[model samples]
Target: MKFKALTLGILIASAGASQAATVNEVFNGKMLGTNQRYFESIAGVPRDSFRNDHTFVVQNCQITATIGDGKVTALRLDLGQGCEANLQSFIGEDAPKPGQTITPGVFGSGQRYTASCLAECGNAADPSAYALWQAPRSAGGMEVLMEMVLAGDKAMTAADEWEKQIKQAAGMDYVLATKFNCETRFNSIAEAVFKDVPVNAITVGYGLPTQRCN
Candidate 1:
């Protein structure tokens, strides 16, 4: 279920699609629109790399992320069932404006921060997508990963349920890199609605890099 031998370091470095955007370039407010694409995490890799967060509603169909340097290095997204219909049903009204200070977790204003969450979407710049470029790592630095779904209304009960479910059945469904004996280290994400489509959950995982690809 994982490309344990896939080396993101190398894969992301070269073989990028003529149209695929870079990770750092994508996450830093350069939100991707429809018909856009990012670099593949691995070459010839199957797109079945999906997992559930709460074992209920969040289904990660595909994901692409970048890890390294101090920067978060990429953009993110999450899709769920029934999301292909309107796409705008989930884009809530509230979004973070520039110069806005929104803190997502327990870290100080220093180690804890987020990039731009709003940049004028195709319709009205909805809070359609918000992802963690980095997370608190266990080794000695930041952590973060990319995965998606949680597309219901922003209910604390639903969020709490998803969190509890993920914690209860962590690695089994939402795993990062199990090869380097790494554990999913990324956490704390915001609701993302694409073109009005609804998303349900997100999880960032970081622990180790994939083995270098040929």
Candidate 2:
């Protein structure tokens, strides 16, 4: 009987070790999640109606979730191909500098803006840029806020400005396309989408990071 109990204990310990190892491997960059959502952009004739320009596919974009929380929190996407120049134009000259990362949050001085840059800007049609958002912890099933494509590098800079903006921009379509409980105002954006969701006991930055952007 003692032998059987010992064996059972070992088995349980092994199982836990396996789960921890898997999560560690993913977080530490050994493995990557396979699921990714793709968004495409459309093209039209140049404002020059007389120009014989052919309409071509703009870009192929994909958003891959980095964590295993069952919802997409952070994502990575490829900006449009060979359009580094165009991308720079969209995001603008003030790109994120050394020690600067464009995350979600409110800027300083009570500015009326929420910045959500993520890697992608939020242009569903254009894959050049993308966004990542985390819904307010209170919103159940809304844990992973929204992810979207950006036009270019400029959005990257703006993303560093604030958190609310990140959520608002990344989840813009979600707010528009879906029936989420929310309140939108000129200086602020809030919603009840996360109200029903249980607030996580763990503060976001308190624990070790579970995901990393490539």
Candidate 3:
């Protein structure tokens, strides 16, 4: 009986320790202002380093931290295949879904903006790729951005096809209308196509705009 009780206590302690190492717990709180050396002590030596950005693998999740002025400014986590379990752990139950109006303060950030195409809307010169949601200039000057992938090689093929159809039906008189119309149409299609797909990557920036949210 005594031996069994001792073993049970040890098992419980081990489980607690394992839970403490989760992605969220390891990366959350007071991380924005920390330095590279301090981050490496917890995240281990980076597998790749480029300028101020360092990529490290923590619990199979690829986390890249951007350091500026010797302090960490941003973190981008690529939750690829086999890292699905960590998704919920990192973002919690408020993970943004397709076509859903993301609640502000979801990631402890302020206002959120959704970009229909991968790039700026109404920009015909830019290629439409994926969908992105950005929450810039949040509390403590932090920014949060999320990305979702679209299907197919070109990804913009559907958007292009729709644009051509609109132009054919509306003629040159409606050339200006095609821009906003196609943008909205492409957003709907992207939402449907990636409804069941999870966010590919999430980036959190501190004190600056990582990707043009404003």
Candidate 3 has an lDDT of 0.52
Evaluated with TM-score, which candidate comes out highest? 3
lDDT (C-alpha) at residue 211 in model 2: 21
The runs of at least 3 residues in candidate 3 whose Cα sits more than 4 Å from the true structure, single-residue gaps closed, are 1-21, 82-141, 152-197, 207-214
Give the per-residue Cα lDDT of candidate 3 at 119. 26
Arrange candidates by lDDT, highest first: which order?
3, 1, 2
Better of 1 and 3 by lDDT: 3
List the candidate 2 regions with Cα displacement exceeding 4 Å. 1-89, 106-214
Compared with the true structure, what per-residue lDDT tens digits does model 3 show for residues 1-214?
9999999986776555444444564455456678876766666667899998888776878888888888888777775554432223223344444334332223332233233433224445443233334332333333455554434433355444444554565554444333433334334443443333345566665443422322
lDDT of each: 0.29, 0.27, 0.52
Worst 10 residues of 2 by lDDT: 38-47
Candidate 3 weakest ten by summed lDDT:
102-111
Better of 1 and 2 by lDDT: 1
RMSD of each: 20.0, 21.4, 10.8
Among all windows of ten consecutive residues in candidate 1, which has the lowest summed lDDT? Answer: 84-93
